[model samples]
Target: MVRIKRWLLAALVMSAGVSGFMLTKGTSHAATTDPQTFISTLKSPVTTVANQYKLYPSVMMAQAALESAWGTSTLTTTANNYFGIKGSYNGASVTMKTAEYDSNGQLYYTNANFRKYPSAKASMTDNAKLLRNGTSYNTSIYSGTWRENAATYADAANALTGTYATAPTYGSSLISIIKQYGLNTLLDASASDSSSSNSNSGSTPKPKPVVYSKATYYGASGTQTARLSGQYATYRLYNHVKGTRANITKTAWSKVAAGKNVLVYLDMRGVKKDASTGKKTTWYRIRFAKNTSAKKYWVYTKALTLPTVKYTSGTAAVKVNNTVSGSYYDHVFNSPYLAKSMGALNKLTAKSYVADKQAIKTQDGYKSTWYRIKVGKQAYWIAATETAAAPQYDAVTYSAASGTKKLSAKYSKYTLYNHVKKTHFNQKTYKWPAGSKKGTKVTVNFKGVKTAYKTTWYRIQFNGSQTNYWVDARALA
Candidate 1:
């Protein structure tokens, strides 16, 4: 049976897994074992993630070191995926052919997806999340690794031997590394009292019991989602730190976006005074993917408020109607009449939602069609002109058929389409393959079935070109 954690995710120089462990770069073995440098470099980031996620810093740091080969592993260097966590982040991923044992316990080679992260800290945060959330099948499978649940980091380390990895020695390996580097030996550097800390080696205090914060900033002014109006880096606020700008790094989320959605974390907002200019910059903290991790980033207000919502809606039921991308709202609106949001859909994992109903709404003379999108247990609305009528495709396979077929003379050239997107593959240039001129025979392979139209599609090599352009039965007439 397939391991629940091994479910393919989005990756890297090294492929992660279809089973347990995938392929890596030219060097399968770890290139370096510099534990000191690795621990030093990752200490701050691991501490932050552990503190936020309620994981043991020592266990997490040890896992990172062992999995990423002390930060010299191919996957770590190329993809920053220290935990061998496979899956995409924000539609980003890398692929590699990995050697692994399938559920049948037979070794095989296959390409697998691993999540790509922006920073090492980001990967650490994601890894911590996996432990906290566990696999979809078992939410409490890794609960033994929680700082609250585990009496010590050693207990947490042992919990991963079979569950986190295929090796029986995985836990001992981590323990050795931790002991060698004195990773878990420290109570916590933050509690610096010379009297108690310097008193004795065996006398260090245990960590204070964790208190879940009940503070909700929402009741202040409430939250809203908005896209960055323009490209400007965000910074974190450190009230306890002496200097304003020096407290936190300036680049929180640097990727620029015009319509990129952000979950506004607070409505009261914040203002940071520039050291040089004395001008206070208004900042709004937000999460890029609201439904995923709860990690937050800050963005200046102007870049977000600049893009005005301009969407065209259509009437009649449509398949995978393009997601309602809103400029001002945090997500698709809950209703055309209300200003509430439904959260943003991730680009890679977001299957097109069906808009089954449409209504006309006029706000301050801005008239548009409001498409009601049904997702899961609830439905939401997006106001704009509708252009979602044509059918798209579902699961496709590459077996079954391959050969040549003659097109009908009715269409000298037919517009090529992206079967999955339900949009023209090429807007201007590609119509029918030049070799597929009216009634001409063209090479076809990889049969696909699109449901709504109940049609068949074939991957055709156009004009001896390698690109796999798609053509449905309509071209065959």
Candidate 2:
């Protein structure tokens, strides 16, 4: 009986040993064969998630490979938690041992709860949502402009270090995996497929034109207002039209000068075809801020390039009794360091009101001072050297006995005008300097009402100039 029992035991032992050996071989084979299969399985699901979330597929694939060990981790193989995402998914979860690092970067293992999904697709979708919305696990790391932050695989990979993983080399490891396997090709293929699908649908793809560095404004002409268009160019008050010359110009415009920006506003009223070129040319219009006579003018579309940069627009508080004195140019610039020349000022004058000031430090290390002033409603900057303070004088009454009454305090430091009319073109006439200094005395020869505007006027002889010109009475103090 004992011998029979020993034989049976030996047979049983041999059978058990054979079974164990087969199981080992099977596991080893799976270990060897599963990586490529796992990667292949991930491709479609990862791409789907990436496209839906505007994430880089290469980034998602690399992260999955690293986090799940090519789908071999117990968390991934059994629970389908590819990203080791730790949370409950519709009440499904698994408690597992995970390695983590504290603020000191020390690695340690701990038992924690992890999320479980029904399939790889669910896992990938959940992972994408986690990245898109972020979580308490690493709020600072993932909470940012999702689409812009994940626009590139490099950016997404770099964002994962320290925050997503404890290892400082986590980002580099994922990047290396992506590059080693040429996973970017998958992204290209996906994009090509998307393009093909779009084309097959007969949908036209129109890309927004990139704004280049330089643009010019073609001057406008006639009684028409110029139009400005485009997303950025919409700041200017003008009619917007799609796919027009103005829209194209605005889209491709960039700042050509330091502070000056320009835009070509198309005047639809003055569209004309050139007989010589056999091409249609549009008229462009520009208006000055303060001056009425020179308020609006038009130029041909061929004369100017569209403006690239958006100019700053607003009103500024004027300093009391402050004046700008300088050699004046008919053209006014938006900024002191001129890049954009808006239009001509009404009158060339030695002095005008000082609105604002800015001290600019140039790239070459030179400091420049710029003054802001209003022409009409538009504000502009000029060089500091062009401004001065008006002098104060006591009021004086006009008398025929003197035939040359001392200039009253009110008129002592006023903007001299050539003519006075009701219209702004005539009202804010050419700005001329009447006195050498603020209190400098001048001769008032005659006073009368302007026949055209029904406004009072004063005929005065300035101290320096022998020629006497008519100054408006309302212009006096």
Using lDDT, give the best candidate's number. Answer: 1
Off by over 4 Å in 1: 1-33, 186-477
Q: What range of 10 consecutive residues in model 2 has the weakest lDDT sum?
A: 1-10
Clash count, predicted structure 1: 21
Worst 10-residue stretch by lDDT in candidate 1?
212-221
Local distance difference test values of all predictions, in order = 0.54, 0.47
lDDT (Cα) of model 1? 0.54
Residue range 1-477, candidate 2, lDDT tens digits: 000100111111112122211112212211112445556767787888877876678878887777665655566655676676776789988886655567455867677667768777788788777777665543333532244434456656766654455455777888898888888776635744675577967553332332212223333222222123223232322222211322122211233211123332232224444322344544444432323344334433433434222233222333322333332222222211123434333342434463433333232233444445656665554443433322212223333422444444666446565433321111234455633443555677766554444566676776667766666564443
Clashes found in each candidate (C-alpha, N, C closer than 3 A) = 21, 28
Once fitted onto the true fold, the runs of candidate 2 whose alpha carbons sit more than 4 angstroms away are 1-34, 101-108, 136-151, 199-477
Per-residue lDDT tens digits for candidate 1, residues 1-477, read 122233122212233322223224542222234456566667788888887787778888887776665665566666777777766877877785556677456867787777767787888888888888888875655766776656577777877755676465777988897787787755233322322556677464554432221211211213334444434333232222112321232322323222434323433344556443455555545555544244555444554542233343432333443454432232223221124444443221344555555554443345554556665656665444444322232444445677787777765545555442243212222566444556676678677775555567776765557876666666764
lDDT of 2 at 388: 35
- C-alpha TM-scores of all predictions: 0.36, 0.35
